[model samples]
Target: MNRKRTALSAAAAGTTAGVVGLVLIAAPAGADTTPPALPETTAESLVASVLTTDVPALSGTVAVSSDLGLPIPGLPTGDEAARIYTDGEGKARVSLIEGDGEKTLVADGATTWLWSSADKSVVKYTGGARDKAGEEQRLTDPAAAAREFVTAMGDESTLSVDGTARVADRPVYQLVVTPKPSERTLLREVRISVDSETRVPLRLEVLANGSAAPALSLGFTEFTPGAQDASLFTFTPPAGAKVTDGNAEVGKHEPTEQQKQDLLNAIKPKVVGSGWDTVYVGTVPADLLESEVTTEDKGGREGGKTTGLDLVKQFGQPVSGAFGTGTVITTKVGTALVTDDGQVAVGAVPQQVLVDALGQK
Candidate 1:
C-alpha cells in the first residue's frame, strides 16, 4: 500500500498542472530578450490560462526514475519508460510494458484506476471531488500543491518571465514551485518549464531532502495536444478477474480462541528475536499455518463472516501483505511472516518454511 500510494502520488503530482506557478525571474545572460514580458502574470492567472488553453489531445512517452531513498528490497532500481496520453482537461493515462508484463493507470476526470496485467486486478479510486477540491486548495489554499510558489513569489507566481534555456526547441519559462513546510512528503522544491508562447508546461524537476536522495526529474516527449479519445478513460474488468472495492468494508472473520493462541505461539519466538523494538501485526495468512485456523466471525445476525487472522508483536520489521507472493523477514528468534499490514504474524507460515525462505538470501 505504501508503494502504491507513493507511485500514485508521484504520478498525480507529475501530471497535475495547477500546483506550480509561473514566475518571471530575470533572464540569464545571452537569452532571448524579445519574448513577452513575464512579470505581469499572476499565479492564479497563469494557472487559469494554462487550464483553459485549447490544445489538441496529446500523446507522449515519459521516462521515470524513482529513488525511494534506498533500493527496493526485491525489485530493481525502478526506472522505466511508459506511454502517456493526456486530454486537454487534465485527464491522463500511463502504461508500462516490460517483457510480457504490463501495468496500466488511467486518471479520467472522475476516477483513477491502477490495473495490473499480471494479476488481472484493478484498483479504482474516485477522484472527481478529490481533484476539484485539490485544485481549489492548490489555487487558493496556502498549504496545498505548489505552495512553494506561493511563498517565493506569492501573487507574482502568475507573472511569466522568459527562461534562459530552451528545452525540446521550445521557448521555456522557468517556474519555481515550493511546497509548504508542513506538506506530507519530502518534496522541497520543484522547477517546471512552461512554453513561453503557448503557456503550457513541458518539463518538471523535483528536489527532495535528507540522506534519502534529493532530486528526481521527469521530461515529457512527443507531446500532442487534443488527440486522445474519450473511450480511453473507461476500463472493463477482464474475464474471471476478482473485483475489490477499496471503499467497501475490509470484511472480518472470527477464529477460535484456541486457534488464536496457537497462532500467537507459532509467531512468538520470531517476534521475541526480531531485532526491531516495535512491530505491528495484522491480516496474517492462515492457509499456510497448521497452528492457526481462519474461520468466519459470527458476531452479528448478518452471519456471512469474512475470514481473517490477527497477531500482535512488539518487535519486528514492517511488512506488507499486498504482495501476492509471500516474503519472509529475519527476526531475533528466527524468521517471521510479514503480513500485508507491515506486521509480523506468528503461524501465518510454518516456522521451518520461514527460516528456509530467509536462508535462501
Candidate 2:
C-alpha cells in the first residue's frame, strides 16, 4: 500500500526467486489438466487459509528482476538466495545471502530490521515510525509482507481456473488473476499457482501490457507452519554493531526553512554544460559540477565532464547514483538512495537535495 511496504514486498519477492529456483528443481512435470476443478475461494479467503495453515516452516532461495519492460540504467540483474521462517503469528525472519555476505531482514510483528553482514549494522524501523518521521518505510510483519501479493491480485472477479501444476512435488492449482475493470495500470494479468490440497499460493506471475514476457514472477518454497519461539520476533544486535533507531533519527532531523531554501537553490539552471564552469555563490560552481561528475565515476579521459553532460541530456535530469546503481532514489524534497532496489535511503541525502539547495537563490 505504502511505498516502503511495496519495497519490502519487492525485496521479499526478489529474495523468494532464489528459493523458488531451488524448489522448482524438485517439482514434477505433467500434462495440463483440461479444465481442472478450480477452488471456489476468494483471494482473501485463500490468503487467510495459507496464513493459518500448519504448513512446514519454509526455507529456500530466491532471484529477482525489476523494471521489467522499461530499461533502467545502473540496475543489476542477478539471483539472490533467501531463507524464510514463519511462525503464523504475523512474524517472520528472512535471511538473504548475496555473494559473500548475508543480509538479514526480519519482522517481529512490531518492528523490522535490515541487518547487513558486510557492515555489521542494523537499520530498524517500526510501522508507525514512518508516519512520525513523515517518510516512506518498509513493512515488517510476515502477514503484511504476504498481503502484498494478495493486494496485487487487483480484481477478484478476474480470477479464473487455469490448470494444474506441481511445485516442490506438491500438486497445485493454477489460477489466472486479471485486473478489475476499474483498475487502470500497465499490469495486465497475474497467474498464481496454488497448492491443490492446501490452497496456498506457490507461485505468482505478473504480466504487463506490450511485453511478451511476464514482468515479474515469485514463488514460495518449503511452505510450513508450526509453533515458533517468541524470540524469533525479537532481534539482538550483534556484538559491537551499531543500532539505528529510525524513529528517533526521523524525529531529531527536521529541515529548517533556510535548509529547504538552500536545497531548492542548489538545483537551479538544471542544465550545465559538460565542461567545468565557475558560477557565483547562488550558481552551481564548475568545480562542483566536476566533483559530481567525478564522484559518480562517469567522467571520461578529461574526467568524464562531457560524458556527464551527455548523460544529463539523455536522462533529461541530473542523474546521481552516488550510493550505487540498483538503489532507487525517492524523495519528499531531497534525494534518497535505495541501497538495494527495494531498500529506502534512510540517512543519506540524495543528489537532488544538493540540486534543490543550489536552486534556492
Highest-scoring model, TM-score: 2
Candidate 1 on 173-211: residue-level lDDT in tens?
666565443332334455666656666666555565443
lDDT of each: 0.49, 0.51
Give me the displacement of residue 259 in model 1, in angstroms: 28
Q: Which regions of candidate 1 are displaced past 4 Å?
A: 1-56, 66-78, 98-100, 107-112, 125-164, 176-190, 207-214, 249-361
Measured against the true structure, the TM-scores of the candidates, in listed sequence, are: 0.41, 0.51
Model 1 residue 199 CA deviation in Å:
2.2
Error of 2 at 47 (Å): 7.7
TM-score (C-alpha) between model 2 and the true structure: 0.51
Give stretches of model 2 more than 4 Å off: 1-62, 66-76, 109-111, 125-127, 130-157, 179-187, 197-199, 209-212, 229-231, 252-361
